[model samples]
Target: MKKFMLITCFIIGGFATAQAQQTSPVWPGCEDAEDVKACFNQKLAQHVRKNYEYPQSEDGEYIRGKVKISFTITEEGKAVVESVEGDKAEVNAAAKAMIQKIPDMEPGTLNGEPDDRNFTVPFNF
Candidate 1:
């Protein structure tokens, strides 16, 4: 019984230590997001400009809409899309396409360690 208790205690301690070490990605709004928004916006814009797909509307006019793409930021500042939200079909496609085109970001940091963070990117055509 005593041996079992000691082993359990050690296991619990190990888990606690590991959990304490885990960190969350810190965004600009998350941590310094306000400071980083400009950088984020710039990067996002560059991505859109490079990847923008101007599909024609049913009326032969160009169609453009805003879409919000939500993604996770890795500890190394890479943005990984979790999901997207919007109405226009093309906008949704653009959101996914643009997200795929996003270069790995400088991962967000928390407690000096890389962490997962979520960010919303708005794509307007």
Candidate 2:
């Protein structure tokens, strides 16, 4: 009986931990949003399209790359760059710029508690 209880507790604890980690930022363009996400997505897309000025390369420089960056938003609603994957130089620079300039994203919530959240970005230049 004691062993059964211990195993059950472990399972429950593991489940809780997984749930906690599952918490993530509300995507900037979720369809369920009333208007906020749409507004931000539209504005952000414009900002990225305009701001990312790829350096000229001899091969008619073009960045056809996609970067997935995980970021966090502070409790006060600020985007923070976390990790970036893709072209080391350009992707990192673009990711940093996106976080710095993209307007605040609505912070994500978990278990009904508002908290900093993890999110991703994809860039194609």
Candidate 3:
């Protein structure tokens, strides 16, 4: 009986912890989505793929690398790029430009209060 009670308590505690997770920000068109985080990621990837363009090198050489970009989503649903890091300058510039084009999103919330959310995406060129 003691073991059963302990297990029950543990299960309830696990559920409470799961419920306490912060909700992810919703993308512009994913406001009504059942799984906001999944929908946001899908939309963001699609948007990036649609808008990505490889920069031409002056020396006519192919540049192959990945650019990692970090940005924040403000309370008012604006994307602000924090940093872009990569091997090639062109790749970094392209990554920043692409991130800048992301549409405004619905701010994430914690306990019903608006919260700023940070996101990182890597662009392969």
Candidate 4:
């Protein structure tokens, strides 16, 4: 018999708040995307998968947990982590660092003016 483990991370999903009806920020290659929101979700999933690093406990065992990450995409198109909620501090920090790598994207609009977009998404590792 052969046995191995697979490590993976996934973004559960997120929303653009009440003003979601307005235009959404565009991901780098999603400029021409027909549905910007869907494109953004796909890009976010890819970002998390590529950047996530599993945290290890003091015992050297890989830690597994779900974190609710709250963040804002500023009017300047930067993604900033506001908070990370989880049972483990290590997991929280790892999740935060992973999300911090989200590349700058086109700023979303509210009432036709550049505005901060808030997103609360859950991630599993």
Which candidate comes out best when scored by TM-score?
4
**Which model is ahead, 1 or 3, in terms of lDDT?**
3
RMSD of each: 6.3, 5.0, 3.9, 17.5
Best by lDDT: 4
Write out the backbone clash pairs for model 3. Answer: none
By TM-score: ranked, best first: 4, 3, 1, 2
Tell me how far the alpha carbon of residue 32 in candidate 2 is from the true structure, in angstroms, after superposition.
14
Clash pairs for candidate 1: 28-32, 28-33, 29-33, 75-114, 75-115, 76-107, 77-105, 77-106, 77-107, 77-108
TM-score of model 1 (CA atoms): 0.60
Each candidate structure's TM-score, on Cα atoms with residue i matched to residue i, is 0.60, 0.55, 0.78, 0.80
Give a tens-digit lDDT track for model 2, residues 4-121.
9999999999998887633344444543656655655666677778776665456886545667777777765687788878865765676577667655655656666668755676
Ranking of models by lDDT: 4, 3, 1, 2
**Which stretch of 10 consecutive residues in model 2 shows the poorest summed lDDT?**
22-31
N/CA/C clash count, model 3: 0
Q: What is the lDDT of residue 43 in candidate 4?
A: 97
- Point out where model 4 deviates above 4 Å: 1-21
Q: Model 4: clashing residue pairs?
A: none
Instruction: Give lDDT tens digits, candidate 4, residues 1-125.
Output: 12222221112123324334567888899999899999999999999889999988779899999899999999999999999999989889999999889999999988788888999999888
Off by over 4 Å in 2: 1-33, 58-64, 105-113
Candidate 1 lDDT by residue in tens digits, 1-125 = 99999999999999877765444443343345554656566656766788877777889887777777888777666666788887788778767877776666556555567767777767667
Worst 10 residues of 4 by lDDT: 4-13
Clashes of each: 10, 1, 0, 0
